[model samples]
Target: MSAPPFIHLRLHSEYSVTEGIVRLQDAVARAVSYRMPALALTDLSNLFGLVKFYSYARNNGIKPLLGSDVTIANEADPDRPYRLVLLCRSLQGYRQLCDLLSRAYLAPRVRGRAEITRRMLREVGVDGLIALSGAGAGDIGEALLQGNRVQAASRARFWEALFAGAFYLEVQRYGQAQQELLVSETAALAAEMDLPLVATHPVQFLERGDFKAHEARVCIAEGYMLGDPRRPRPYTEEQYFKSGEEMAELFADLPAALENSVEIARRCNLQITLGKSYLPDFPTPAGVTLADFLRQEARVGLERRLQQLFPDEPARARQRAPYDERLQLETDTIIQMGFPGYFLIVADFINWAKRNGCPVGPGRGSGAGSVVAYALGITDLDPLRYALLFERFLNPERVSMPDFDIDFCQDNRWRVIEYVRQKYGAAAVSQIVTFGTMSSRAVLRDVGRVLDLPYNFCDQISKLIPVEANRPLSLAKAIAAEPQLKARIDEEEEVRELFDLAARLEDLTRNVGMHAGGVLIAPGKLTDFCPVYSADGGGSVVSQFDKDDVEKIGLVKFDFLGLRNLT
Candidate 1:
């Protein structure tokens, strides 16, 4: 293959929250249409979309460069941080990047932004990473924009020395003020310092047409009116994803900048293993394998359970035959599936919860259908008595991780979670993240507010969008269902713009949240599987990927849902 002309090195997806308008699926499709071979997703401060992006890109024959657009604390002014894009070239680089990103969220935030200090960069030691100067928004770009060549060069040298040969001075042309000057100065600095210059589009949206929607999304996020002069309008329409030909034409005067983008893409060869289980090892007695220990525990526990049901030894003997057959079959299946450790781990925590007087629910989901679960006291229900099929929980025919929805008393759920954390190693366990998107009515309200539309007018239009069974209609569906809503938009230019803007921004991720019930127990440090995030400096830590994504990456999600009635 004649070297792929150019690759996008700094594109953000919806995981960047309101700042980016590009969805992973749409971004990948756009790249394929452009005939590009590789693309990078450098979402702001997190690899929240890494696994999904990686899967989609690889499936579609595109190289996936996993990275983050991280904010680095400015030494002189911590509140004013400079943006930097760091892409992983190896698994070590990935882990280090995860550590840095996790630290940024877990540390005290500067101006509500997740940022790492210079000290953090030095301590973490960047290896197997390809660092990009954040174009016009980076430290060097900021210095160059301010006519401080010395400061710019000094900053470039620091990164160059730190990243070794993996650092590149980034140049972009988005019609932003001083961008042309930045490109020229960055090129000179690159030559003077013998550093490489790489080109990027800094893509926020998929196309130029989505610019207004992107701006409205930002306005909604920053609580600014679209017409407000004081609002920071940092992005431009030209920041959309451009074809390689377009990028080549734009940077024709400096061809190496374009070539280096391809080179960086080629160099970033990180591979992530997906769809394989990474179960944590359960502690067992010496010389006892997980399978053997599990069988021993199940048999002993079942005997105690059966003894209660059949007080007479003769009746117990008759009952024991069937129970013994069922137990052996279940144990064989569990061992065959290599889930003896998983069962042991779940039982350990559940038994602990029970012993400590924390009420756990009878059981929920398919896991209640397992005879093994009943024998081990993971569930209160007896599978055979209730005629619940073990195949529903685990089947030799269909191989997948067995999921159990476990409920604990609302007040004491944390106690059980805490126990699991300590048992499995605190760093190995974390709650999962959830993305909250802009809903239909809420999107209209936000768009209208930013558009400076009247309150009752916006409220009336929003009210016209109906809700059914607590699920609001999508913006498109709402417009179709309510003819009045469509008519109002058709009649008034302001209403048209409001609905137009709202429609585009609808269903875009607006905020991050922790999953209420889902928690992950990794085989090692959680970062080895996925990055962790904390809203507060040092409270609850959550996996950056949500429940579904975490499961795709092979970290089993254990539901520890809280129930008030169970209290």
Candidate 2:
């Protein structure tokens, strides 16, 4: 195939914690619009978007260059992390990249950022990897700008030897004065060191028109004013998805830099397998099969429950036979659907909680509708006695894993979690992550605060937005529905700017947070399927994917909720 003039190799999707503004769907659409064959996602320091990016790119017949802009510990100033660009050249590179990511995040906490030391690169092993001298903010470029050409050259040679055949000098033309200096000095350094030059357009948003909203997002993250000159602007409006011809002219004299982006695109081919369940194996008794073991325990529990509920033989005859029939039918459906192990695991944990004297909730959610749960002692509610429909729990029409919402005494929940952690292995358990988005109401308040408007003024205007506990109105919808909101926007220029900008900013994620009780028990180490990060840089590890995403990848979520009323 003929070489395309350029391809975007440095991009920050929405997953890049607070700075990037490009949505995954919109990024794919822009690639299609340009008729470009490939694009890359280097979201901050994590591959949080890798699975979605790879699948979407391959499905749309576009190649995805998988990589990240890693924040490595600075040798000179350990507190300040130095940015470095690393891309995967093959599946082996992806694995090594994952290894590096896990170690850095799991390391002891740092005040500002998570990072791996530059010296540790050898141990991580850059076997099937490609390295880039990152943007002017990166280690090498910063060294050059500080007039330390020797240190910059030494750093370049270090990476050149580290990545072996795959190191490239990255030159980005984003309209900075230092960029020209970086290019001139880097071109000389590249020639001397025999490194190839690759051009990358540092993309933060989808289009040029999105600059205002993107800046506002950066301000919200960094807590700066739009007019604040103390903080330097790291990007320009020119950093958008550019066409091949537009980039070709940007580097007309050094065409090899543009051509090498296409070359880098050709080297990356990542395939992510989606939708496979990774449930752990329940330890069955020495001789029994998992299905038979579950059946035996459930039957024994049923007989004990039967005797307690119906003491007289005459009552046993009336109740026992029907309860036995319901148990058998539910057990048959569970085993046939290959969920015997699922049931056994849930029972083991609930029984352990009870043995340890934790007060467990009787039943909650659709799983309460199953007689199997009652017989296994996972739920105390009797389905037949309560007349709860078994079809609602595990329908013959829809065969899926049944979820049980278990509640432990609020104080004892951790002991129960500690027991499970010890039983299943700590590496296998994690809390799920959830995103906090800038909702319609939230964006108005945030934009008002940063714009330095008065609290009463912001509140009075925001109150015009009609919202409910479950439902939220979009800014446009609010303007249409409320005459007062519409009149304020029509008459006041500040109000109009606030409304316009807030609308663009709404639905962008604000921060990462923990799901109250959605704990995922992976079959093995979670890195086998996805990445994990500490919530707020401490406490339990969280799956980068949220509850919905966790289910898609086959990690069963057990909600061990805490109830306020119980407290």
Candidate 3:
């Protein structure tokens, strides 16, 4: 009915590793319902949701504020970590944010949560970034609550000097106890220091009632039972996405904070270019372009293959011109499309695996249709003999990444990954992170337990859920397909309640897992493109972005597939 009063400037959309429960799509829907013009994603220690959040926000008629709730190294005490909310004001700001987050993982230190030191931050330099005096639990706010106002003021001033005019004192009122006290003290300090103020909602879920399901998510993440106060329980029900009016009323006395959020949203101007193909460069010899090198290699390999495949001179002669013509045609298409590097890169790894006695498949999928692949030893198929279409592999019309699903010997795939890391620099390569969303049956078990329903009861209801042949059906679809599930829902009230809650909690992120074979390689250290994360601070380093978004932002994905049947 009226102009939106405020915009949410701090939100964690499941990309906060284990802590966030809101999916980016659902968060956007909630923001749309609030009729707000802008929203922000400040996922902890990573920008995993940045590309998708930004793209989706724009598509949904909202300005997306880019920020992170990064865990920073406490310079005075390295053992203790402090969290800060950093938001970007421009393209330069986004780059700085990426560099800062990248160094957090790249630092030569013992593995733990990814963190960058103040010294590292200074080296990277905060140019277009806006620093927030992280409201409650932020360095400044926590220092105030801990009765270390001197430290709080020092920290605030340090950020103010670093951020220059781009800094603001972040005030949030999420119905927490010490929030008002922190806000009052921080506001007076900001006035004394001439720092601006901005209000944030710090959302974790779409609605307040989703807290129980969110709690189940936390328990599922940390291996804790509900009410297990000994473990980390950092969020409250108030962390839900509040309406702009609700937030404005919460900080009614300090409208300046609310207005400043709008100002910050206005300053943030990010333009993400989607659907562009970004492949990693494969190093060629001096004075040789990848296109030229690939052409030379494929031609020689094809000639040698023809001699071997057809031992008779007359038979080989018959195959020669057609094979050469097909090879030239495919090569032209690849070179014209700017994908010679992609072909060369795939060939190198496959050849590496084959040389080391690791079984490499001839080729699978549409890639089998290319004669150039047969020449390069990337595939064994003779496209001419099979009458396979070259357009299926590298179409002149299709504009997408030419995905070569290379299957390596099941056990030796790790060696290939390690080789890539060593050659490309460990920081340049990372396995893609895949999220495990709470599925229909899964939510029934999780929410059922949280609601203190018996295990047998939960299991019985879950078993009634149908499993389709190709893809699993949704709860609604399953209920429609299975009469037993419908009958149970109609007969028992507890069953109806469980189904109700499970349906609501379904599709929220439950856990993080490594993608089966998807690995991302960058031209430089990956943090320049996207942040990397780990399962327990070490071991397999995974790209924070998933399969689709990983490609959307321009990091090339190479699926190093492993199949026993291929061998």
Candidate 4:
């Protein structure tokens, strides 16, 4: 039988943050191009690309190995740090890895340095996990480079004991002289210790030609002059993904290294399954179901609101026949739609906000069209009085989430979030994460900085391109818009080069930040349902999913958007 295809145990994508330039989709495409069966994404320190990687790989008929390049404390001296690459071989292993990574960042420690401890690994590391000694800067490589072969071997022995045959000595050759020597030494040590040696390229780019652009990115990140020969740069262009024949040729002297890669792929059998929402159980008062309680409260509240609005009306005149019928219909609709708890949850905090003197707006969007919301105090506007249709707010004919775009005083919005956190357990509530992409203008600026182009020349060229807020300007569009730009591209090689690199990098997510008022609340612990990230100030947990993806994963997003006008 033909041997299983080689698996790339160590690969990085654009999610690696300036270090790697291959987008996740392009990476999968490249792997498929080579007819590779599976690949692993060990992006630096975070599984930011995990879900996307998994979905793309699976859809493209390639298996995705879920892993992360985590910084771990040095064994001999817990102060020094080095990265260790861990891959999940089973569902439990994936969960264990998530827990380890979560604790590594969430626990109190030094500001910038986040490292997982040996104690954490022992406690949380599950069975069916494959451990790889990371590339040149990894723990074992650092030890070996320091000429401490015994220490490196000792660490290997410890990992072998912890993970048994699941631990492999990961050796990478990126054409660096040091990496060449380290790989040879590591392979020898693995053989001596009866451990397998796996070969990897430490892939950061998809093609050799991408090296220059990737290097420019590195310079931008390190705040260094690209032309300066003194700046530390990546060892070589050999860091791009290579074919199986290329890997075989590179490790021809030690065939087992290439063979071990296939073996590792055969051994790893894990897949990350997207989970359902874990919405918290909305507490019901004594002798009343959540649905019943919501209806009772909304009805009583609506009557009081009508009385306050028309206090001078006689009782006979106040007995409007339609008011009670509308209330009953809205209440029945809300309960039947399985959203009584959702409405109550939204109303509770809104009420709390107003009571505490926090300014709340009348309403915005179709949510203002709900009479029940006006009754429950979820909104200040009267739908009946304003001639707003309830169907527009809660379309029974077309089922959709009841969205209330609440506007709160910007200054006191956090008070509302704090109240929600207090009412629901802290683990149940969190902000949604959003990413910022490098747009056409921004990418032009980045490339110009790296190419060392004159500031005014770059600014003038950028200004020539017409600005479109929603639609970014393409190189072709820019050429069409400005005759001078086309002339510069045709005449100057450097100008062309800047545009070429910028075009490639544009629209790539450059950084991540929290969404302003999009909070997701679950019925159970969020970590059980989805991954959570601690906010910058360590104040709140943020879901890794964006607004739309959060809904796809079954968590409804309630946008308690803060508006300055509310103040």
Best by TM-score: 1
Q: Point out the higher-scoring one by TM-score: 1 or 2.
A: 1
Q: Write the per-residue lDDT of candidate 1 for residues 1-567, one digit (tens) a residue.
A: 453489999888889986998989999998888889999999999998999899999999989999999998987977678888999999999999998988888898787877888888888889878899997778999899899999998999889889999999999888988777888988999999899999888999987999999998888878899899888888999989898889888999999999999999989999998888889878889999999999999999998888877899998888778778889999999999989999998899999999999999999888988878998999988777888888888998899998888999999999999999988898899998999999999999989998898999889888999898998899888888988988888998998888888888888889989999998999888887788998887598999998878988889888899999999
Each model's lDDT: 0.89, 0.81, 0.82, 0.78
Extract clashing residue pairs from model 4. Answer: 278-523, 279-522, 279-523, 280-522, 280-523
lDDT of 4: 0.78
77 Cα displacement, candidate 2 (Å): 1.6
Ranking by TM-score: 1, 2, 3, 4
* Position 151, candidate 3: lDDT: 87
lDDT-best of 2 and 3:
3
* Candidates 2 and 4, the one with greater TM-score: 2
Q: Model 2: runs farther than 4 Å from truth?
A: 1-4, 89-92, 147-149
- Compute the lDDT for candidate 1: 0.89
Can you write out model 3's per-residue Cα lDDT over 1-567, one digit (the tens) per residue? 875789888888777757677889888888888888888899887887788898889899988888898887776676767778888887777878887876676555533677867887788888778777667766788788888888888988888788788888888777678867888888888888788988888888788888876777667666677766686666788989888888888989999988998898888886666777667768889999988999999998998889889999998887688888888899999999998988888888888888987888878799999988889888888878889888987777877888988888888888998888888888789999888878788878887886667999899888788888855568899899999989989999989888877787677766778999999989987877776776665567888778999898888899898888655
Ranking by lDDT: 1, 3, 2, 4
